[model samples]
Target: MSDKSDERKRAARDRLEQQRELDRARERRRRTLIVATAVVGVLALAAVVGLIAANAGKDDHDSQAGPVATPSGATGKDGLTLQVGADDAPSTLTVWEDFRCPVCAQFEDAFRDTIAELADSGQIKVDYHLATIIDGNLGGSGSLRAANAAACAQDAGEFAAYHDVLYRNQPAESDDSFADNSRLIELAGSVDGLDTPAFRNCVEDGTYDSWVEKSNTAFGEGGFQGTPTALLNGESIFPKKGDEEISVAHLKKWVAEANKGRKPATAGATPSP
Candidate 1:
């Protein structure tokens, strides 16, 4: 009987020891899991912080990227207007255009000769305002790049010719070919005395990029609906003036009536568009 009692006590002691060992193992695993979770949380927080810092650096670089270099002889508000006719002409024709806008290209194609005749005859002065709405609407920099290149052409005293050239070689609405500086320089070769080192450097360096940005911003603030916004004497007259559809004859008649008794500008000769 004594031996059996001793054996039972030993068995109970072994069972209790085994349970204590299992409890210790569970505590160790819980501690390890908590440490692992804390480590993962710390790593995740560090990654987020690193990403924020990187973005902040990029923002700083972008803010100080380019200088606001306005083209020479730019007139009107903020020196954004590129005038293309006699300064003292009787009527003022304000034109807002985008390089990538097909409608603007169509308008130019339809009225280029008439508008040039009017401008050259000192009947009206054309105020050209460049915009980059297409670049904004589409996900590309073609409009901005082409506008800058045109501004560079303006600096070289070939704005009218270069402007016509750009329209003549304008790409499709979805095509961003104008973003290539080489292509812009290549186009400049067609203009007389326009494909110089200065012009190339200007296009390559994006000298007028900030000016283009400013012009785009102004376009947004002007409450204008879209590109090819034409105003004669501060009144909208694009597709139609009042009741009459705009035509070549109508344009001449309107200018004639506007300048009824007034004499045409006798100032210096303006470039033919």
Candidate 2:
């Protein structure tokens, strides 16, 4: 009887020890799972914090829907053509040119001063139509980009100065440097008050790209070919025959003759379509 009692007590103690061991194993697993979950959550939070810190210093404002509103009193088919001088002026000199067009650069350089002087003196109204034919021909975005930048400058009331500066600093026809937005901003700085934050955003975001496309289409639909096309009083005045390299003197004389022959002047003659 004593031996049986001792055996029963040993068996009961063994079963109790096995239960205690199982309880310990379960507790260890629960602790391990808790610790792993905590570690994973902390890592995920750290990654989010790092991402926020990285983009915090950037000025990535969402682009506006379209270009700044056209400057007041400017008239054209949706600002596709930039017109200067009194609308009543006797002669309307319409010019079709692309910023990246080599010949356009030459024409601008040669006749820039005369054109500006005449327009300022109320002798003629100059209409500048932007074109991107060079972009299509040369496979670069420079023509379109530069044209858009010019429109942005127009919004700042610095179109004339900016226009001259663009032609003055025009890159080689084969080079597409103007395609870079940074370079376009650099050019804007050439014209005072043209490199503002608004202008920068306009150029970077291509605010006037649609306008440029429309102007290019207008150039084609107007039955024009190539850049540097000149029209005086709605008549093609592109140098011809022996007048291939027309001089400023000849241009002034031609304007004088056209003015002399203009039927009684009206002060509010908008450019012919």
lDDT of all predictions: 0.91, 0.82
lDDT (10s digit) by residue, model 2, range 1-273: 999999999999999999999999999999999999999999999989988876663434324433645433457677667876678788889999999998888888888999877887778988888899988988999999998888888787777788888888899999999999999899788887779999899999888787788889989998886788998888777764134447798788888988896642344333322
Q: Positional deviation of 150 in candidate 2, in angstroms?
A: 0.3
lDDT of 1 by residue, 94-181 (tens): 9999999999999999999999999988999998999999988897999999999999998987898899999999999999999998
Q: What lDDT is reached at residue 259 by model 2?
A: 88
- lDDT score for candidate 1 against the true structure: 0.91
Tell me each candidate's TM-score.
0.75, 0.68
lDDT of 2 at 34: 100
**Residue pairs whose backbone atoms clash in candidate 1:** none
